[model samples]
Target: MARKVLTVLLPLLLCVIAFAGLLLLSIPIRNVREPPSYKYGIVLDAGSSHTSMFVYKWIEEKENGTGIVSQHSMCDVHGGGISSYAENPSEAAESLVECLNQALKDVPKKRHPITPLYLGATAGMRLLNLTNPAASASVLSSVNEMLSKYPFDFRGARILSGQDEGVLGWVTANYLLENFIKYGWAGEWFRPKRGTVGAMDLGGASTQITFETASQTEDPANEVRLQLYGKSYRVYTHSFLCYGRDQMLKKLLAGVLQRHSTHPCWPVGYSAKVFLKDVYSSPCTSAQRPPDYDVSAEVTLSGSGNPILCQQLVSDLFNFSSCSFSQCSFNDVFQPPLSGNFIAFSAFYYTMDFLQKVMKLPVTSTAELRTAAKALCNESWEKLLELAPSQKSRLADYCASATFVHQLLVQGYRFDEHTFPRIAFQKKAGDTSIGWALGYMLNLTNMIPAGQMHFHKGTDHATWAVLLLIFIMIILISLVMIFCFARSSKTQSAI
Candidate 1:
C-alpha cells in the first residue's frame, strides 16, 4: 500500500516541480522581450553665453515609442559660451576637454564608440553667424575637431534656428514631464489626463516661448507641428534673440542711458562705469548705439530701483503698439491665445530661485513678484552681498533681472495673475533638465533604430524556443522520475 501511494504521488510531485521550473523560467523569458542593454547619447548645449554638456541614456528597446531618455550626467564649461571665443576658436574646443573627460568617466568605455556626440549652438552663435559668418564657421569647426578626437561618434556642430530652439525646448519640457506619452498600467503607452504644458526659456542671449494651442495660428511662421509616439501636437514658438537677461540688461541700460543718466532698474546706492561699446556691440544693441558716442566711451550708472520707473524702462524695450495680427505678444509676433501651463526654465529658474531663496518670498502672483522685486531692488547692495555671499557676481543685477522677467511676462507675453501662477519656474524635471538639447537628441534618436530582437506576435522564435525547452525538460524529468520509482518498486517486490 505504501509503495502504491509512493508511485501515485511521485509523478504528481514531479509535475509540481516542473510547474515551479516553468515559473522560474518565465522571468528570463519575459526579460528577453524587454531591453537587453542600455544605449547612450551625448548632447552639448553650446548656448550664447555658456556651454553645458549633458549625457543621456535609454533602454535599447521599449514599447513606449522611442527609448525613454533621462539625463545621466551634466557638465558646464568653465568659461563663457563658444561664441565668446570668437577671437580664439581653438580655446572654445579646449574648453570642452574637462567636460568631455567627465563624460568619458560617466559613460562606460564600451558605449563611447557607439554613442553619438552632438553640438548645437543657440542664439549666441546665431548672432555671431549673422555678424561674422567666417568666425561662426571657425568656432563650429574648432569645436567639431575637438569633439572628433574623443571616442564618441562626432556629429558636426550646427546652429539651431530660433524657432527650433523654442520648439525643442517645448519638447524637452513635455517629454520630461511625461506630457507627450505615459506608460499605462495595461502595458502600453497612452496620453495622460493632463494636457501638454507650454515652455518658456530665458537664456543669456535669448528667450523662447512655446505652447500647444487649439486656436488657429494666424502666422504660419510661428506654427510648429510635431509628431511624437504616434500623437500629433501643434505648437506656437518664438525665440526673441538678444532678449536674454544679459542682452535685456544691455537693452535697459542703453534705452535708459539714451535719454537719462540714472538707471531706475538698478538698486539704490549701487554704481558702475560701463563702456558704451560693451553695451552696443551685439546686433540687438548695435542698432541702438548713438551715432555721436564713441564705442570705448565709459559712463557711470546709478541705481534707483524704482518699481514703476524700472518697469517703464523695461517696457521701452518692447513694441506693443505695432501688432499686424489679431493678437500679438510684443514685437508684432503673432501668438495664439495663451493656453496651458508654462514651464519657465534656465535664467528664469535661476533668477527666481535666487530671489525666492534670498528674500524667502513666495512669487505666486504678479503682486507677490512685484513686492519681492521691490524689496530686493530697494535693499542695499552691501546688504545683499552680505546675505548672499555666493551671488556676488550676479548680486547687483538681481533687481533688474526680476523686473525684466515681470515686465516681459506680464506685459510682453500677457500672462496675468491667473496665468502667472501656472508658470513653473524649474531648472530640471527630476534628474533631467528642461532644455532644447534633450529634445533635439530625442528627435535625432528616432533615426537610430534600436537593434532589438524581432519576433511574431504570440508565436515567435523566442517564445516557442522557451516553451519547447520547458516542455522537453518536464517530459524528461517526469520520465526519469517514473523510471526511478518503478525500478525501486520492482526491486522491492523482488526483495
Candidate 2:
C-alpha cells in the first residue's frame, strides 16, 4: 500500500512541477524586454544672415509616419551668415568649426561614422550666386571640403532652391503640428485626412509663402505636389527674394535716397553713409543696378522720422498692376487665397516680438504697426538703444523694417486685418524651432516611409498578458485533475 501511494504521488508531483516551470517560462517569453535604442542626425541651416547647427535624435524603433525626431541641441555659429564670407570663402568654412565641435560633444562617439550631416544654404547664397557666381562656387566647395574632414557622413552640401525653401518650411510646420497623422486613416496614421497649416518664413534675404489652396493652380510651376508619409499634399509656394526685411530696408532706402539726401525712413538722431551698391545690388528692386556700376558712390542717410513716407516707399516696391492668374501675391506670382492659418517665423517673430514687448503694440493693424514704427523712428537714439541694446547698430533700421513688415503682409501678401489673427508668430513648436532645416533632413532620410507599422503597446501587451494568464490557469486545472485521478486509482487498488 505504501509503495503504491509513493508511486502515484511521485508521478503527480512531477507533472505539477513541470506545469509550474512552463508557466514561469511563459511570463518572460510573452513579455519581451527590448533595450532602448536611438538614432541621430545633424542639420546645418546656413541662412543668409546666420548659421545654426541643429542636432536631432529619435527612438530607433518608433512608427514611421509620425515625426519622432526632436531637436536635441543647437549652437549658433559665431559671426554672420556663410554668404557673408563670399569675399573670403575659407573663413565661411572655418566659421562652422566651432559649431561642429559642439556637435561632436552632443552626439555619441559610436554614432559618428554613420550619422548624416547635411548643409542647406538658403536665399543669401542664392543672392550671392546671382550676383557673383564664382564666389558662390568657392564658398560651397570650401564648406564641403571642411565638412568632409569630420567623421560624420557628409551628405551633399548645396543650395536649396526658392521652391524647396518654401515647401520644406511648410513640411516642418505641419510635421511639428502632427497634422498629417492626427486625423489619418485606419490602423496607422499613414494618410492625411486633415488640412495642413500654411507656413510663412521670413528670413534675412528672402521670404517664402506656402499653403494649400481650394482653387486649382493653372500654372504647373506654382503648384508643388509632395508625397510625405504616404499622403499626397498639393501646395502653392513661392519665395520672394530681396523681400526680406533687411533687404527690403535696403530697397526702400535705395529708392528714397538720392545721393546725399536725408532719407525719411531713418530714425531720429540717426546718420549714416549707406552705400549705393549695397542698396541697389539685389534683383528684387526695380531700380537695381550692378554693384560695380555704382561702386564709388554713397548715399548719405539722415533721419527725418516720418512714418507716412516709410509706408509709401515700401509699398512702391510691389507691382500690383499685372496678374495673369485670377489672383496674385505681388511680383505676378499665382497665389490662391491664403487658405489656412499661417505660421510666420524667423524675422517675422523677432519684429513682432519687439513690437509687442518694446513698442506695446498688438501687431494686428497696419495702422498700429505704422504708428509704432514712426514712434520708434522718432525716439531719441539713446532711448532706442536703451530699449534694444544688443541691436544698437541695427536699431536705426527697425523703424523701416517694422513698417515694411506691416505693408508686406497687408499689401504684398494681401492679408486682411481679419486674417491677421490667423498668422501665428512663433520661433518654435515645443522643442523644435520653425525652419526648413528639419524638413530638408526628413526628406533626405526617407524617415516618412510609404507604409507604417501599427504598434499599440497597451492593447497588444494586455491581450498577451490575459491570454498567458488563461493558459497558466488551464495548466494548473489539468494538473489537479491528473493528481486526483492518480490518487483515486491508487486507493481502489489498495482496497
Candidate 3:
C-alpha cells in the first residue's frame, strides 16, 4: 500500500514540475505591447527677463521599448519675474497656470495623471536678496502656495546660481549640437564636419560662453571641457550683476548726471531716484520696449569714456598684454588713445561686424541686437510691451560692438586692443526653444540614452552586450519562480 502511494505521489510531483517548466517557458512569449496611455512632461525655463514653460509627450516602441518623443505645440507659459509675482503671487501663478492649462485642452483627460511638471529658475531668481530672513521666508511661502494650485505634480523647482545656469546652458547647447544638428534631421539639411564648437549665450541678465573640444575620432563618448563666467571673480563665468543692458544704463545715467552739475534735470541725486522709481513703479514699461534707447546710449558712452586709460590700467594690472590681446593677429582698432566712449562704441561695432561680416550668423542683424544695449532696461519695460506687436529699431552701438567682437575673433585680433576676447557665434538650424525642450525631455525619458551617456571609461559595444546578456538571464530566473508557484498543485488548489 505504501509503495503504491509513493509511486502515485512521485509521478504526480514530476507532472507538476513539468507543467511549471512549460509555464516558465511561456512567460517570455506573452504579449509585449506599448502602454495604452502616453506620459507627458513640462519644463519651466525661468530666466531673468522672462519665464517660459514647454510641454512634451513621450513615445514608446512596441518592439524594443524605445522610440522618439515629440513636444506638443503651443504649450508654452511665459510671465514676469519672481519680484513681479511677489506683490501678488496668486495672480502671477494664475497667469502662468492658465497658459499651461490651455495647452492641455487638446490632450485627453486620462493622460493628465501621467504628466509631470518641473520648474527651474536661472540668473534672475538667483540674484534675489534672500539673506533678509523675513523677506526670504515670505518669498518662499508665496512661491510654494502659488505652485500648490497647479494641475500637474511638480517634481522639483529651484533657483540655480549663475554659474550653474552657465554650465547647464553649455550642456544644453552641446546636446543640441550633437543630437539635433549632427545626427538627426539637421544632418539632412546641412552637413558640416562636427568638431570642437564654442557657444556664446547672451541672456537678459547675463552672458555665458562655453568652449568644447570634440574628439578627433568618431567616438560618441568624448570628454567635454567647460568654462563658465559670472558676476564675481568666477572667471570660469562672468556675471555682471546688474550689468545687463537696463541696469547698466541706469547706472550710466546716474553717473553722468552726478558728474555734470550743469545738467538740465532735477536737483542733486533727484534724477537718479526719480528714474529708478519710474523704472520700478511705472506700468508703461515692457520687456519688448525696454528703456529709452537714446538715453541709454548717451549714458554708456559717457560712463566708459577713456578706453585707452582703461586698457592701460587693465594691462598694467594683469601684466600680460600678449596673453590678453596683443598676440592676436587682428588690429586693435577698438583700443584706447580713443576716448572711452569711442572704445565702448567701437566694441559694439566690432561685435556686430564680427557676427554679421565674419561668422555670418543669421539673426545677428535682427532689430533686437541692433538696438541700444539698454533699450529694455527694467521689469516695467517688459510688462508694457507684453502684448504689443514687434517693432524693429537699430541700436548702432550694441550691433557695432557685437560685430566688432566677431571680426576680432575671425581676424585673430590681438587682446591689447580690447579688454575681452572676440569669440565666434555658430548658429545651427532648428535651434528654437522647442527643440531644446524636446531634447531635454527625450534625455529625461531615456529615449536617447546615447545623447546623455558619458563615455568616460572604455566601455564599448562588447561591454554593453555582456551587460544585456546578464540582464536577460536575471529576468529569465525571475520568470521561472513566478511560473513554478503558479503551476504547483497545492498552490493552485489554495487559489
Candidate 4:
C-alpha cells in the first residue's frame, strides 16, 4: 500500500511542478490595453487688450508620463479684456458668451461635462485690481457666474500674479521647444541636450523676462523654482507693469508733450489728436501730468521722424541707475544674468515682424534693426500705406514700437548685438500660442490629474487560450486522480 501511494504521489508532484513552470512562462510581463479616451481642457487668456479662449486636448494615459497637450482650436473674444468693462461688470460676462459658445461647438458635447475650464486675467486685471478693487471683484464674480452656467467644469476666474505670469510664460516657451522633456530619436524620452530657452513676452500693458539661472540670486522674490515632467528648474523672472506697447506709447506721448511741442517718436507723415486726459489717464503717466493742466484739453501730435529722439524717449521709460544690487536690469530689479536663447512673442513678434516686412530683409542684429526702424520712421506716411495698405492702422506705430523694443532689449536688459541674434521673434510655437495659459493648465496637472488611459501588457490571445486550456486540464486531472486513489485505497482495505 505504501509503495502504491509513493508511486502515485511522485507522479502527481512532478505533474504539479510542470504545470507551475508552464504558468510562469505563459504569464505576461506587463499590463497592456488600449487607451481609455481623449481628454479636454480649456483656458481663457484675459489679457490687457483682448480676451482669447484656447481649447486643448490630450489622451488619458501615456507611456512616458502625462499626455502631451496640444491646442485644438482658438477663438478671440470680440471685445476688450474683462477689465475694460469695469463700469458695467455684467457686460464683461456677456462678452465671453460668443467665444464660449464657439468653444462649445469646437469641443465635442460628451466631453463638456468633464472638460476643465479656467480663466486667468493678465496685467489688465492686475491694473484694474490696483485702481478699482471693487470693480475688479465684480468683474471676476460676473465671469465666474457666467462660466458656471456652461457645461464645462468651471474652475475659477482670477488675476494671475506678475511673477506667476512671467514664470509660466517661460515654462510654455520651453515646453514648446521640447526643452523640458525631449523625445529621443531612438523612441525614448530624455532631457534636452542644449538646455532650456529663455522667454520674452510683451503684452499691451506689461512685458515679462524670464530665464534659467544658476548664480545665487540677490533677491529671492525675483527667483522662481519650478518642476515639471520630473525635472526641476531655477529661473529668474520679472514683469514690468506699464512697460507694454500701449502704455509705453502713452508715456512717450506724455513725455513729448511735457518737453517739446513736436513729437519726434512718431513716424513721418503720421499725426494724431488726443485729449490730455487720454495721454495721462492711467497711473503710468499720471505723474507726468501738469499740476494745473486741463484734462479735456485737446493736444495734437505730429511725427518728426527722428530715430535718435525716438530711441532717447524710449530709453527714458526705465531708470537704469537705481539698482541696489550688484547687477540689475533697469528699475532696480535684480537679475542674475540673462542666460540661453530667448523666444520673444506677443508685441515683440509684431514689432520685429513689422520691421522685417517693411525692410524686406531679416533683422538679425541690433544695428540692422536700428537701420530698418530709421528707414521706416523716415518714410512718409503715404509710402507706408502703399507698402502695407492693409496695415495702415498699425503703420503709424511701427517706428516707435521698434525703437522701444530696441531700447528695452539693448539698454534695459543689457542684451548686446551677439545676444540679440539669439532672440527668435515668434507669435506661436507650432500651432500653440506661446503664453501663460497653456503653462497654467500643464502645471495644474501636477495637482489635479488629467483624465488618464487604462493600459495593460499581457500575452497574445492565442497564448491566453493555450494557457487557459492547460490550466483547466491540470485541475481536472488532479481531481480525477485524487478520487481514483481514494476509491482504490478503500477497495484494497476492504478486501
Candidate 5:
C-alpha cells in the first residue's frame, strides 16, 4: 500500500520540481536588456481662441545622473477653441480626430498599438459661469463621449483654470527660451541690466501675467510668485468675462447708442461689434474688400486729425475698458474716483516718455518719450522691410551702418523691437494706462523660475524598459528552479 501511494505521488512531485528547474534555467537567459517602445501620442492645448493638437514621438537622451530623458517632436492640427466644440461636441471631435487620423497616415501600422492621445482645455470652458453651465458641461461631456468611442489609446482630458493657463504659457515660452534662444534679457528687447522679467499673455476671454526674477538663480524653484492683484482678483489671471474683441465692440457700441439719442460719430444704428465680427469672421480677407474699416480708420480717428473728438472717443472706450475689472471703483473719467482709463493712458505715455526722453534707452531720443515712441514705430516698419526675403541680399547691402535700432530709439517709439512687436508695443507703449499697467503688474507678480515647472509627467522609455526586463528575469528564475526540483523528486522516488 505504502509503495503504491509513493509511486502515484511521485509523478506529481516530479512535475512541480521540473517547473521550478525550468524557471531557474529561464531566469539568466531571459532577454533583460531590450525594452519596448511606446508609440507616438497626441497632445491638445485647447484655448479660448484656438485649439492646437500635436502628435509627438518620444526621443530619449541620456544624462550622467538622470539616466534617460525623453522629449517630443510634434505634428500639429490647427482649429478653433472649446467654443466651437460647445456648439457641437461630436462634430468638433470628429474634425479633430480626422486631423489626427490624417497625421498618422505616414506612420506605419506596426507602430499604432502603443500610441496615446491626451486632451487639455483651457480659458474658454473654464470661464463658463452659472449662466452658461449647461452649455459648458454639454461641450465637455460631448468631447469626452466622442473621444471614448475612438479605438486609439487615450490618456484623458482636463480643463485648466485661467492661472493654470498662464503657467502653461510661461512654461512653454521658457522651454522655447531654453531650447531655442538660450539667453536671457530685460524687457521685450535686450537691455544692459537683467531686471525682473514679465510675461503678459492676452487670450480671447482672459489674460495672464507671470513675473520672475530676471537673473538665473542657484535654486530654480525659488523664482516665481503667483498671486492675484486685488481682493476680488484671482491671481495673475484676470479673465474679463465676455470682454473679447467681439464682445467689447458690442458693449462699446451698445453703450454709445444708449448714451447718445442719435448716432454720435458714425451713421445711426451702426453696430461696430456686429459689423466687425461679420467682416472678421467671414472667409474674405481685407485685401479682397473695399478697405473702408481698416486700422487706417482707427489711426486717422486717434491721431492728429480730430484730437478732441478722438480723445472723447478714446476716453469713452477707456471707461468701458475699465468696467471689465471688478476691482476698479472709479466712475467719471478723470473725476472723483480716477478712471482706469486715465491711469492706463498716463502711465503708458509717461513710461514711453521716460524711456525715450529721460533714460535715452536708445541714446538717440535724448530720453524724450514721444520721440522714442515714434522711433520705435519707425524701427518696426524698417524691420518689417528687412524681413522680406525677396529683398534680403540687396537690403543687407543697403542696410549699411544706419542703426535702425537707434533710429527707433530716437523716435520715442516702443514698437518693432521684438518678434511680436505689436504685442510688445501694446504692453510697453501702454504701460502707463491703468488697464495695461495692471496687466503688466499682474504679469510681473506671477513670474516663476526655470525648472520649477513641468510640461510632461510620465516615466521615460528607458525606466519603463528596465522595469519590464527585471520583471521577466524574476519569472524565468522561478521556472528554472522548479525544473531542477522536479528531477530530484523523481530520483528520490526511484530509490
Candidate 6:
C-alpha cells in the first residue's frame, strides 16, 4: 500500500516543481534582459531666421504612440538662415554639414543606416519660391544632394505649407502632454475634451495660429483633419505670411521712415542703412508689389527712442476692417473666440523672456509689458547692450520686438488681459522646446496611425494571460494523471 502511494505521489510532486520553475523563469526573463533597442530620427527646421536640427529617439518596437518619442539633442546651424544663401544655394546645403556631423556624434553609428533625415523649409523658403523660383529649386536641390551623402535614410527635403506648420505645431504640443495616451481616443472609455492647448508660433518670417474649435468650419482651407492613436481631430489653423515680427518690423519701418529718418522703435545711438528692396520684398506690404525704388537704394535710419510712436507705427500694419468670416484676426483671416490656453513660443517667448529678465515684469500684465518696452526703448544703446549681452546682435530690435509682441497679441490676436495670462510664454516644455519640429517628425513617422491603437498594455496583458493558462493546464494534467494511477493501483490490489 505504501509503495503504491509513493508511485502516484512522485509524478504529482515533480509537476509541482516544474510549474514553480516556470514561474521563476518568467521572473528572470522579465528582469534580466535589457530594454528593447531605440530607433532614431532627424528633422531639420530650415526657417527664415535660422536652421535647427533635432535628433529624436524612440523604442524600436513601440514607436507608434505618445510618450515614446522625445528630442535627443538639437543643433543650430551657426549662421543666417538657409534662405539667406539663396544667391549661393550650394552653401545652404554645406551649412548643414556641421549639424549633421553633430547628429552622427549624438546617435550611435549602428543607427546611421536606418535613421531617417528630413528637411522642411518654412515661410522663408516659401518666399524664396515665390520671389525667385530658380533660386528656391537650387536651394532644395542643394540640401537634397547634401543629405544623400549621409548614412541616414534621406527623406525628401521640401517646403512645408504654412497651414501644415500650424497643425503640426498643435500636434506636438498635445502629444508631448501625453493627451492621446492618457484619456485615450481609441479605448473603450473615449472621453474627448478640448484638452489640447493651442499653438502660436511667431517665427521670423511667419506666424501661425492653430486650435480646436467646436463650431463648424465654413472654409475647407482653414480646416485640418488629423488622426492619431485611432482618434480624429478637426483643427483650425492659419499661417499669416509676412506677419512674423521680423517681416512686420520691416513693413512698419518702411511706412514710418523716409530716406533719412529718426526711427522711434530703435534705441538712442543706433542707426542702420535699411535697404528699400529688403522692406519691399514681402507680399505683406500694402502695395502688394515691390515699391518703385532703386534696387540699390538704401535709407539711413536713426533712433529717437520713442515707444508711443513705435506702437502707433506698428499698429498701422494690422488692418481690422475686412472680415470675410464671422470674426477675423487681421488681413481677413478667420479666428473664432479664443477658448483654450495657448503655448506661445519662438520669437514670442524670446522677446517676452528678454523683457521679463531686463524689466522684471510679470508676463501676465499687458500694462507692465508696454511700460517695460517703453523704458527699454528710451534707454541708451549702451545700457541696452549691458542688460542683454547675449542678444547683442538683436539688441537694436528688442524695443520694437517687445512692442510688436504687445500689439500683435492685444490688438492683432485680440487676446484680452485676462486671456493674455493663459498664453504661456515658454521656450520649452520640460526639456523639449515648444516648436513645430517634433510634431513634424511625428506626422511623417505615422507614430499616430490612422485607425488602430497600438498599445503596450494589450500586448503585455495577452502575454501574461497565455503564460498563466499554460501553467494551469500543466497543474491540472498532473492531477488527473495522478488520480488515474491511484485508481489503477486500488483495482489491481483488489484483484
Winning candidate number (TM-score): 1
lDDT of 5 at 389: 47
lDDT: which candidate is best?
Answer: 1
lDDT of 4 by residue, 1-495 (tens): 688878578658756865785666455443356535667889999998899999988866552343467899999999888888999999999999998999899898998998999999999899889988999999999999999999999999879988999998998888778776654433334566678989999998999999999888999989887766566678998999999898898898889997877788666777889799878767788779788989889978888888788778888888998999999989898888777889999999988888787658567998887787777777788788888988877777778898888888888888887888899999999999999988898776552233332223355556666776777677668768777888987998899
Count clashing residue pairs in model 3. Answer: 58
lDDT tens per residue, model 1, 1-495: 887887768777877787776555444233555446877889999988889999998876552344468899999999999999998999999999999999999998998998999999999999999999999999999998899999998877899999999998998888889886665432334567789999999998999999998899999999987766556778999999989888888888888888777888776777899888888888888878887888778988887767778767777888999999999999999988888888999999987998888878879999888788878878887788788988777887888899888878888899998899899999899989889998888777663223332221324446656775886687688788788878987999899
> Model 5, range 9-84, lDDT digits (tens) per residue?
5655655565565444333232346754434555665656666555544322211111111223333346667655
Residue-pair clashes per prediction, in order, are: 0, 0, 58, 9, 63, 0
lDDT of 2 by residue, 1-495 (tens): 797677667656765765775555444232257665678899999998899999988767652545367899999999988999988999999999999998899999998988899999999999999979999999999999999999998897999999999998999898888876553222223444568899998898899999987689977887987776555678998898888776777777667764326767777787888776676756555455553456668756678777777767767878888998888888788788878788999988888888889767666766676667667667776778788898877778777778778877888888886787788989999999989998888888877665542442323456656765666676676677677877888899899
Question: Where in model 5 is the C-alpha error above 4 Å?
Answer: 1-41, 61-80, 85-87, 106-113, 179-197, 213-246, 259-495
Structure candidate 2, residue pairs in collision: none
Better of 4 and 5 by lDDT: 4
> Which of candidates 5 and 6 reaches a greater TM-score?
6
lDDT of 6 by residue, 135-205 (tens): 99999999999999998998889899999899888888877766665533212223245477889999988
- The list of candidate 3 runs beyond 4 A from truth reads 1-38, 62-70, 74-79, 106-108, 130-137, 179-193, 213-240, 260-274, 278-389, 392-431, 434-495
Task: Write down the worst ten-residue block by lDDT for model 6.
Answer: 183-192
* Ten residues in sequence with the least summed lDDT for candidate 1: 447-456
lDDT of each: 0.83, 0.80, 0.39, 0.82, 0.38, 0.81
Candidate 2 deviant stretches above 4 angstroms: 1-35, 63-67, 182-194, 281-286, 290-294, 297-299, 365-367, 451-495
Model 5 sits at a Cα RMSD from the real structure of 19.4
TM-score attained by model 1: 0.84
Q: Which tens-of-lDDT digit does each residue in 306-336 have in candidate 3? A: 3232222222211223433323231221111
